[model samples]
Target chain A: MKEIYLDNNATTKVDEAVFEEMRPYFCELYGNPSSMHFFGGQVQGKVTEARGRVATLLGASPEEIVFTACGTESDNAAIRSALEVFPERRHVITSRVEHPAVLTQCRNLTQRGYRVTEIGVDGTGRLDMEELQAAVDDDTAIVSLMWANNETGVIFPVEEAAALAKSKGALFHSDAVQAVGKLPINMADSRIDMLSLSGHKLHAPKGIGVLYLRKGTPFRPFLVGGHQERSRRAGTENAAAIIALGKACELAGQHMDAENTTVKALRDRLQDALMRIIPHARINGGGAERLPNTTSIAFEFVEGEAILMLLSELGICASSGSACTSGSLEPSHVLRAMGVPFTCAHGSIRFSLSRYTTEAEIETVIREMPPIITRLRQMSPFGREFLKEQS
Target chain B: MWDYTPIVKDHFLNPRNVGDIPDADAVGEVGSLACGDALKLYLKLDESKDKIVDAKFQTFGCASAIASSSALTEMVKGKNLDEALAISNQDIADFLGGLPEEKMHCSVMGQEALEVAIAKYRGHEAPVHSHDHDHGPAYPDQEGTVVCKCFGITDVFLKKVIETNRLTTPEQVTHFTKAGGGCGGCIPKIKELIDEVMGARPEEPRKRPEKLSNMKKMQLIQEVLERDVRPLLWADGGDLELIDIDGSKVQVAFRKACAGCASSGNTARMVEIKLRDLVAEDIVVEEVPA
Candidate 1:
């Protein structure tokens, strides 16, 4: 069966162009960028060019970009550096809906005698800016928020939130892992002191990420070792993956309009069709501004793992916020923080699109999704009651 | 993705008896929308009102849940009420070629529904589905206080699962019954219940032998400490190492959270009790500096 890959928020297929760009670095151009020989000097030039490409896409200077292993590493480095740089500060601020990369770090800090406040989200998955405003005080060392939620695709007003943090002398960081390529971000005119982005989310290979540090920002190194990444991040560079990410970023810049237009249309058509054809279903973050490529739909009276299993049988890949799929026995933290009802929270399925998502795939999903919901509902006791009431 | 068995996938894809018998003689329902999974099982008894002539199920849950329900209906079709009640959650899992450990609760849900249906059929008051308020016991028919508020599970229900599954840890209890899977405020209580249930087991194989040499007694003491005592401490994020064994006195040092805990004295007393019960009646446990 032909696979209809839709789970882009989880990860994306490496773009062919990005793959080609990194192909030569594995064995042929296998020189460390820091080596003193001529062979290493040539590889260093390519590395510099790649850095410039990545910088261009983010509207950041090449000097501000420090390559890390992946988005988690970038997130860790950004948050840890801020807390270390401001030792007198004893508080951290984040949101309940942040990815585990940021949320876990902030939570672990509490064990070390640091106060951590997690701002809640409203019903539409929108950040409670008022709660953030109230939480940010002079003792707060950093405020870490995600630019866009991975599950609901709800966008956060990080620029305004950063201003709030700045007013309190707290460094603001954004984990833009899900937002960087899908949404245009210009760090040059932003108040965000640190920004983290991953490679695989935007069609680059995995194992490469960037931490954008604003120039003149007071900082401390998270990893102290050899002078790779200007000693900001230690360990030998993942040379090939870095090259891949740079090419992917340049391509993302060129395809930004298409992502917003063509891809957005595909997502809307899928969402509208499913809502129309299926009964007792609702979009999770329908009231909020969301990324163009993502839609989370909650099918009532059914669980998400059952829906996903049926979809997997038909080779239609997607993800779920249901407790069963997550192995947590509770629904997604993102949906839970949004105050979604348990009836819907246990049944939410997320479908994330990418530039490679075709119109036919969306049509296939629209056609196949209603029956899957219908079949599961037919087998559900609650669904039977709802059907009886309808009759 | 869950490593669902082939039998599970087959059952989920084409579930057996996937609807209600409107004239069902005995209907049993367990779980709620809030719990993320639920099953409504129906049984049509024969004219004798003893044997289950037909069984069907309607489920709102994951693949394993649906599969477990389907497997239960298939397993109980021609069995009498007593025989059907004899079916354990493990039997239901075994019928489906075994479910994942985390998905064990699905099989337990199937078994609970069966018990509720049979109890209701016998004209006994089974408050399995009476979840009208949050503060009341989740299953009023069952005894004991509520433990997991998120799932509205009671201590009696948790103990039953823990005992039947031979579960030793709080995490295993969560997998089987979702007792401490929520806010986990009741985790300490769950651990106490586990100890209570495990301690009450009949004819435990870990009992101390009646006659033993000093060498055998020392080995048995170490075995009991490693096998029984340390695991219980580890559950509470504490640990202990046997530092020295001098005659009847067993010297130990606490590590992690147990080292300087205000309750270390109490913990040491508990260890002494366990050692006496399992190793030797006169054995003593002493706390020593690390």
Candidate 2:
């Protein structure tokens, strides 16, 4: 069977165009961009040009974009940098439902005597704006929030959050790892003072990410090492990955319209069909505005691991809340935060589409999923009880 | 993804005889929805000697939890009470090679059901209800709050399972209670209670003196059989007659309730085997029907 991959939210396959663009840098153009020799200077020009392309994608000046290892590093740099800028501001504001990269960093900061006010989210996984606004005070140094949730695909109101932080005279940062390419975000117009984006989320290879620090933004150096990324982010540049990231951005810009419309339709169809076929199944964050490409569903009485395994057998690639956590034992914290019942939480599956996803692939999943669910439920002692209880 | 052992996968994918059997001889229930999982075991007994004739189960939880219950039913069926009681959680995991350590409680839950079922058949209440041991703080009064919802473990259930399993610490309670292991919200309280129960040694330890004379061993064994072991056997429609004791070996013959039981092997394991485990490992015992 042709593998039907639907877990784009987890990661995407590298685009061919982006790969071809990066191939030469791996072998032929191996000279360090920092060297002053003619051979190295030529590669430096290519690196500078790639930087400009990435800057164009985010509507930022080339000087403002600093290449980093990945989105987590970018997020850590932005948050830690802001904390260093205003040491007196001991409190920071963030949401409870952020990705672990942000959450763990916040937790580590909390351990270091910094007060972290973790704002709650509504049932739909949307931030509680009132609580967020109230959380900011004189002691609050900055506000960090994710532009899009990885699990439920719920989009936060970054513009409004930015305005809130700006009004409070606190720096605002966003982990836009899931948002940058899928949605049009302009660093020039947006109120976000700093932003982080990962290449893998936008069809670029892993290990390459960009951190955007708007001009005159209060920040401190996170990585203390050799001067690279214009002394903003230190370390030798991932020359090949950066080139691939630049090309991926170019492709993202070209395919943005198709991704929003065609991919949206495919995702919607999958959601609708899954709901129609499976009883008691519903989209997570149904009331919230989510990314067009991601759909998370809770399959009652079915453990996510069991479902994912069954899907794997059929060569259908999809992710589940239970399959993505600690030892694959804990359900998605996002689902738990939304007050999802354990009966369904363990059974939640995320089917994230991509521009590469096809109608035929979606059709195969729609046709195949119900039987798989039924088959799994039959094996479930809990599922049998749930059906009996409902009946 | 971790590759599942075929048996673990089989139990997870097609758990045997799931769902409750109404009008069952005994029912053993553990865990709850708030605790992330729960199990309900229904059993049919032969009644005459209290041998389990059939077992069915229903569970709500993760893959391992469901798999454990499924395996439990398969292990317990066709075995007499003593034989079934001897089946430990390790045996369950070993049957499938092994499960991940995080999933060890799945096997623990299986063994718990067997223990609970055996308790029910003997008309003995689970130790969870006994108010004998008073650990430090008073147990929670609210039913819902008392139970650690992540693992479906209650303080009452924890106390009982701990006593029954001879668990000495909060970690051991986790093995039996399956609490403090899920969300870990209740770990501190669980650990505190376990320490309180196990901190000070019991005034009179359950373990007999290190080395007793052969005469003393025989006298004690006779006393244990008449007081503890015999009553339990008689309640289950079985009786035992002491044959001989030779150098830590006690030979016994079956009588009354277990005279010709098809599950006599189980009865022997229960009476003879349990005697060995409870008394001393060195005190080997053999069961031969009279």
Name the candidate that leads on DockQ: 1
Clashing residue pairs in all predictions, respectively, total 0, 5
Model 2 misplaced regions, further than 4 Å: A323-325, A328-330, A379-382, A385-391, B19-23, B47-49, B127-178, B182-185, B189-290
Enumerate the candidates' DockQ scores in order.
0.65, 0.27
| TM-scores of the candidates in the order shown | 0.86, 0.82
Off by over 4 Å in 1: B127-141, B200-290
Write model 1 residue lDDT over A135-197, tens digit each, in one string.
899999999999999999999999999999999999999999999889999999999999999
Candidate 1: interface RMSD equals 0.6
lDDT of 1 at B95: 81
Tens digits of per-residue lDDT for model 1, B1-290: 78889999999998999999989999988788878899999999999999999999999999999999999999999999987987778778878888899999999999999998999889985444443334343344554567787777888888888866778899999899877777778789999999998775446466657877889888988987876777677555467889988888999998755778889999989989988887788888899975
Superposition TM-score, candidate 1 onto the true structure: 0.86
- Candidate 2 residue B79 Cα shift, in angstroms, is 0.7
What tier of docking accuracy does candidate 2 attain? acceptable
Q: What is the TM-score of chain A in candidate 1?
A: 0.99
Residues A98-180 of candidate 2: C-alpha lDDT, one tens digit per residue: 89988888888878999998888888888999998888887889899999999899999999999999897899999999987
